[model samples]
Target: MNPDKTLAMVPADTLVVLDFETTGLSPNMGDRAIEIGAVKLERGQVIDRFSQLMNPGFRVSRFIEDYTGISNAMLAEAPSCAEVMSQFAQFIDGCNLVAHNASFDKRFLDAELDYIGSGYSGEFVCSLLVARRLYPEAPSHKLGELVAYKNLTHDGVFHRALADSEMTAQLWLAMLADTQKPQLSFAQIHKLSKTPKAKVPLYLSTL
Candidate 1:
């Protein structure tokens, strides 16, 4: 998984949507990612998504197996993190990331890249923050719950990166429509990336 190999597959400046299924939470606590998915968006549309299962170089926990339905046997034949992350980073070059919980995905991704001798300081937008602000009336902000509430059944295979990324992209588009503000500018979103100084009023949703 060389840089040149990745560049040859995807072009620059594409909007890369990302998702991950991990062995556990907190990269700082030794949790490693087991799957990665990235979707390229160009011209405000999804062009393609890259996804692969990864061997996290550790045993899968019983909790992880119960939650994601991915076990050690499933990852025995999967690629390594460096291998899949290389391809993911290639597709994501020069593109802003969109994800449900941006920090969780970004932290692990950054850790993996850093571990592989790559540095990352990319821009990102979080749909979870957006949901907390825009859909205050909804009780749950989790992606799966949102999918069910929105009735957007599209054969999503959870614990797989690509499928989750695709679903997140669709959910974001739907949210834009719901808010009647489809043309939000880059500057506006950049502001969203900032940590708000004061606690703002958030709406309460009925779950």
Candidate 2:
């Protein structure tokens, strides 16, 4: 996979929204990322895309195969996790990242990168956490629910990495649209996502 060299070339200003479909919930229990997806955003627009499925060296559960539509047969034809992550490490290097339910993705990212002796330098912002503060009136903050709540474009697909990342990118851009700012620094975006739901209005006033 040819990574976008510009991502590392302009590290400080780039935002990459990412998502991963894994074998299970916890990396500590040996769950591995089967697929990774991401879209690079520039000035609130998607500028580049990435998606890859990796072989985890073992078969996933029947349930996971059904849920993600990734099977042992498919994984056998894909590159190994270490091989795919090496490219992914370059793909995301030196760029701030956003993910829905980021804690889960971060676990796998950190773990896989560790195995490959590679890692990213950028910080992470959780779209899930940010949605709670930005759309407090929404019935749910899940990627799928928020996609529906905010009328984000979706192809009726979930549990797949690329589609979820695309939808999350829409959800993220919608939140930025709420800011009404032409550009926000990485620090500002990080701060906004971390702001309390009640004080979000006051904080945006400062922005």
Candidate 3:
């Protein structure tokens, strides 16, 4: 779906907070997503979730396994990336997406979707970029660090898809409140994230 046609129907707060635990850094270099996790948020509440481990048809590097706690044993019985993403495509239907470092997720999402001849209609907002504008003084904008800085609830899990997506969801909500700009449209926030930090206040004020 074209973002223009759907943006009007989709509210910024009604979105899927998504995360992908992958085999390595670049999908272009043949990396693949080992797991996909997401939470559907409607009006500030988590209404649904999607989680799955996808076998990439190869063993994950020891560093990747250690970093994400997703081992070869875990991927051995999982479905293929195409199968999992087909289901995920439905899960995120007609909803905008959010992620901590959205560029990374977007790359994998596009590449995986390309393999299935599918794609997302909704645009994505980067919580990391939004947080940079909203919490410039925070110790760091990394998901875990921002969660700690903002006092968002968590189970002390990181790198795993579901845990990270949940933290990102909480952080997104917090930033919404911090904006103090009620009922702002999704496009406004999207633009704000891309705006320079020093100009964020001014950009939002004009919106």
Best by lDDT: 3
lDDT tens digits, residue span 1-207, model 3: 655666745567888999999988899999999999999999889999999999999999999989999999989999999999999999998888899899999999999999999987888899999999998999888899999999888999999999899889889988998888768777888888899889988887886
Candidate 1: regions farther than 4 A off: 1-14, 190-207
True-structure RMSD for candidate 2 = 4.3
Which pairs clash inside model 2?
Answer: none
Model 3 lowest lDDT segment of ten: 2-11
lDDT of 2 by residue, 172-202 (tens): 8888777776466666767778887788889
* RMSD list, candidates in order: 6.9, 4.3, 1.5
How accurate locally, in lDDT, is each candidate? 0.72, 0.85, 0.90
In candidate 3, stretches whose alpha carbon ends up further than 4 angstroms from where it belongs are 1-3
Winner on TM-score (2 vs 3)? 3
**Could you give candidate 1's per-residue lDDT for residues 1-207 as a string of tens digits?**
754334333322246778989988899999999988877777457787787889988889998988888889999999888888787777776566778899999889899898788754446778787666666677798998787777776696776777888888777767655644345443344343353423322211110
Deviation in Å, model 3, residue 16 alpha carbon: 0.7
Model 3: lDDT to the true structure: 0.90
TM-score winner between 1 and 2, please give it: 2
How many residue pairs in model 2 have overlapping backbones?
0
